[model samples]
Each structure stands twice: as C-alpha cells, then as structure tokens.
Target: MENVVPFKIQIISILATLGFMYFIVRQIIRGKLREEYSIVWFACTIVLLIFSFWRKGLEQISLALGVFYPPSLLFLLAIGAIVTFLVHLSIVNSKLQSQIKDLAHEVAFLKEKQLNESTIK
Candidate 1:
C-alpha cells in the first residue's frame, strides 16, 4: 500500500517473516517440506523482509519495472509464483501416478507367475 505503515506494523511484519522462515526450516528438517519446494517460500519471505525494512523499495522496483502501480506489481509477482508452484506440484503428482500404475502392474504379474508355478508343482 502507498499509505504509510506504522512503525509498529513494520516491526510486526519483520517479526512475522522471521517466524515464517523458522517454520519453513523446521518443516524441512522434519522432512515435511523438501528444500526445492521451500525455495519459493523463502524467496517470497526475503522479498517481504526487504520491503518491510525499506518502505520505498516497492516504489523503486515498480518504477524500474515500468509498473504504474506498485501494489499491482506485487500482486502479479505473487500470482506468477503461485501458478509456477502449482504447475510444479502437478508435474510431480503426474509422475507419482505413473509410477504407482507401473508398480501395480508389476505386482499383478508377479502374483500371476507365482500362482502358475504353484499350480504346476
């Protein structure tokens, strides 16, 4: 927002960002989140930290990028990041589905072969 954020708000934002980074790191350590997947989250948090500390940062970036409105640029970047993350997740899901299907077929073939051998004996 072009409107001024109170000093309290800025401090709160910084604290919240640090908290988020801590949570992400914990998740990675616990194996709940993968490093590659956390990269986007970390990048976003870093950008937020920068903007929180440097209030004029967004305006400068918007001007440099030729965006008339700074908030819109932030929204655009957020949406792009979310879309990229979703696409990556979708690709991973597709691969897992294929692998699962192949495993099912292999298991079925082994059971059939085992049954045939038992019957022959």
Candidate 2:
C-alpha cells in the first residue's frame, strides 16, 4: 500500500505539471502572455515534468546531493526559477525605464523648440 501511494503521487504530479504547461501555452496563444515571459514558465514546467516522470532519477540526485528529503529539492528548484524570472523582469524593467526617460526628454526638447519658434514668429 505504501508503494502504491508514492506511485499515485508521481502520477498526480505529472498530470499537474502537464496541466500547468497547457495553461501557460494557452495564455501565450491567446496573446495574454508574452513569449519572453512564457519561455521561463515553459522551461520550469518542463523541468518539473521531467523530474516527475523520472522519480528514481530525482531520488538519486537528492541522495548524491545529501538532501535527506527529496521533495525539498523540488522546492529549491522552484525558488531558483522564481528568482531567475524576477531578475530577468527587473533587467527588462530597467531598460524600459531608461528608454522611457530618453523619449520623454526628447519630446520635451522638441516641444520647447516648437514653442520658441512660434513665439519668435
């Protein structure tokens, strides 16, 4: 019975991962999610699905890494993925901020020039 429980859990995990991947792809297809963002999500889901399908491999890795609890490894991977995604977003946000500032300055200068020309005319 105990052996059956672990097998059931593994099956459920794979199904859940598949469902998540489907949701992410659907969002991308609907244009609700950008491809750039979806790429990270897809990679995360794929990694999770791979681990779920290969439970013995995951266990071996955990043992080799000296992690007593194999499930904790999953949490660690999830955290790493989230941190990577956030860093990517932060970098993109910084670039967009600089571009917006430059554009605002250019618009202001152009408006000032037009105002001066009108005043002189």
Candidate 3:
C-alpha cells in the first residue's frame, strides 16, 4: 500500500472488507461456520475497519492509554485475537469431549450386551 493511500482505493478496500464480513456472517447464520470460529475473523475485520477509516485515531488512543507507540496497538489486537480464538477452541473442545464420553458409554453398553449374549449361548 502507498504511504498515503488514495481515497478511492481506501474506499474500495473498505467496501471489499465489508462484503467479506457480510459473507462470514451469512455463513455463520447458515451453520456453515460456528460462532466460535467467527469471532476472530470479526475482530480482525473490526480492526481492519478501524485502521481503514481512522488509523490516526490509533495514535491518539495509544497516547491516551500511555503506550509508547501507536503501532503497538496492532500487536495488542493480535494478542487479543489469539485469546479470543483460544477461548472459542476451548468451548468447542468441551463440546467434543462430552460427545466423546457419550459415545464411549454407548459403545461400552453395546459391548456388555454382546458379552452377555455370548455367555448365554
């Protein structure tokens, strides 16, 4: 990207990003993607939206927050995004664990039934 991006290009980027975000939301709503997986992308897009519109605002916010530099905000956001993704994965993992437990129980029950039938024979 140019140091000073043209307004038209910025507008186009913003529109393209918005379109992508809309597509993501549609996919999530349609069950093609889960809420957990969608959050990181949402945060990423929101960051991009902010950057696309008001990158200078980041310096102001950083100054207000007593940060050394503005670009550090990107790193902060990256960490936040990672944490959000990890939380989502944890939730999904818990759901998977429960399902696995249920399946194991079902398998055990079937095996026991089979064993009893074999003993009867």
Best by TM-score: 1
The residue ranges of model 2 lying beyond 4 angstroms of the native Cα positions read: 1-5, 117-121
Residue 103 in model 1: shift from native, Å?
Answer: 1.2
lDDT of 1 by residue, 1-121 (tens): 5643567888999999999999999999999998998998999899889989998777888889999888898899889988998999999999999999999999999999999999999
lDDT of each: 0.91, 0.84, 0.82
Candidate 2 lands at a TM-score of 0.80
Ranking by lDDT: 1, 2, 3
**Candidate 3 structure quality by residue, lDDT tens digits, 6-83:** 578779879988998999999998999978778778978987887779746666677789986666776887888789
Error of 1 at 59 (Å): 1.0
Better of 1 and 2 by TM-score: 1
Listed in order, each prediction's TM-score against the native is: 0.85, 0.80, 0.65
Report the error of model 3 at residue 10, Å. Answer: 3.8
Report lDDT (Cα) of residue 65, candidate 1: 90
The candidates, ranked best first by TM-score, are 1, 2, 3
Error of 3 at 44 (Å): 4.0
Q: How accurate is candidate 3 locally (lDDT)?
A: 0.82
Q: Which stretches of candidate 1 lie over 4 Å from their true place?
A: 1-4
In candidate 3, residue 69 scores what lDDT?
A: 64
